[model samples]
Target chain A: AQSVTQLDSQVPVFEEAPVELRCNYSSSVSVYLFWYVQYPNQGLQLLLKYLSGSTLVESINGFEAEFNKSQTSFHLRKPSVHISDTAEYFCAVSDARGGGSNYKLTFGKGTLLTVNP
Target chain B: DAGVTQSPTHLIKTRGQQVTLRCSPKSGHDTVSWYQQALGQGPQFIFQYYEEEERQRGNFPDRFSGHQFPNYSSELNVNALLLGDSALYLCASSLGGSGNTIYFGEGSWLTVV
Candidate 1:
């Protein structure tokens, strides 16, 4: 079975400040990790993904995450955030378990990031 | 092209009633997946349909059923809906395989009054 845990429910940062969102996962087998962002009343957009190869991956919008195998973590970070970055972020893991649903994703509770000017 | 489209953007039903939600996948997408998002929670995978067959299912009850047509469109049917079922139902479309990035729709909000 695979499960995701997001330690923070909400994070507030001033504009142009650095931000970090923590995520951890538990899976008996190899897994694929991802971070998604959902703006107000909008569908989710992919932030980044860690499938294989480099443990560190980045999104074009200046967000990056490192896939720590030993720690079972994929924490999202941005050196500087803008007010437009305020949104709900989700961390997910996929593994071969359960049936169809679980086989796709085991998402965390989601973290709300609020960037203030 | 539209990323993904769900019908009846918002619906209101009562307990013990039934509701059917519809979805049309993005162009070139062969797989459609359904998810349930309660207030302040991440989207929970409900099921996945591929090749007009149910290729995956979640921890939902039997009351939660679905269908897939040859055109790759899909519908989610819920019987004996409960108040707890009041939430946003999202439809996501991916490529022909499982565990893909999966693009999501704006979602259909179902309020059980």
Candidate 2:
């Protein structure tokens, strides 16, 4: 089975400060990794995904995540965050070999990112 | 195009009661999946519907059932609800084949008293 672990339950950072949300996964086979952001009472939005090609993937909002195969990590980073960046971040994994709901995602508990002013 | 949409944004039900949540997939999407998210926890897969049939199901009990319409809409029904069932029910839609992106709805909040 595949599983995702987010080391931080919560991260507090001031606006304009850099932040990193740590994520690690355990899976027997190759996997697709993703980061999602959820604001209060809203659905999750895809931040970025690591499918193929480059080991580093970036979102449009200046956030990026590097897929580290040896470390089994996909940590999300932002050079500088703003108040609008405050949300819950989730790390998820899906089997690279597709079949039925096996394509379904296994997500970590989530890290609440609070960008303070 | 409009994204995945779920109905009954919030509702409360008593134990032993039944509840149903509805979802309309995004335009051009043919597959629908349901998930249950407890407070402060990650969402858990419930099932997936494709071609108006159930393609996959998670470890949920028989009390959890679902249906898919020809129009690609779906419904999630839970019978004999328990307090543990209180959580946010999310509906996600995607294309049937490989490498498709799945989009989620805002979710329906179900509270079992």
TM-score: which candidate is best?
Answer: 2
Residue-wise lDDT of candidate 2 within B1-113, one digit each (tens)? 89999999999999999999999999999999999999999888899998999987888999999999999999999999999999999999998776677799999999999
TM-score of each: 0.95, 0.97
Screening candidate 1 with a backbone cut-off below 3 angstroms (N, C-alpha, C), the clashing residue pairs are A100-B56
lDDT tens per residue, model 1, A45-116? 888988778999999999999999999999999999999999999998887333232246778999999999
- Chain A (alone) TM-scores for all candidate structures: 0.93, 0.96
True contacts kept of each: 0.42, 0.42
What is the CAPRI rating of model 1's predicted complex?
A: medium
TM-score of candidate 1 versus the correct structure, residues matched by position: 0.95
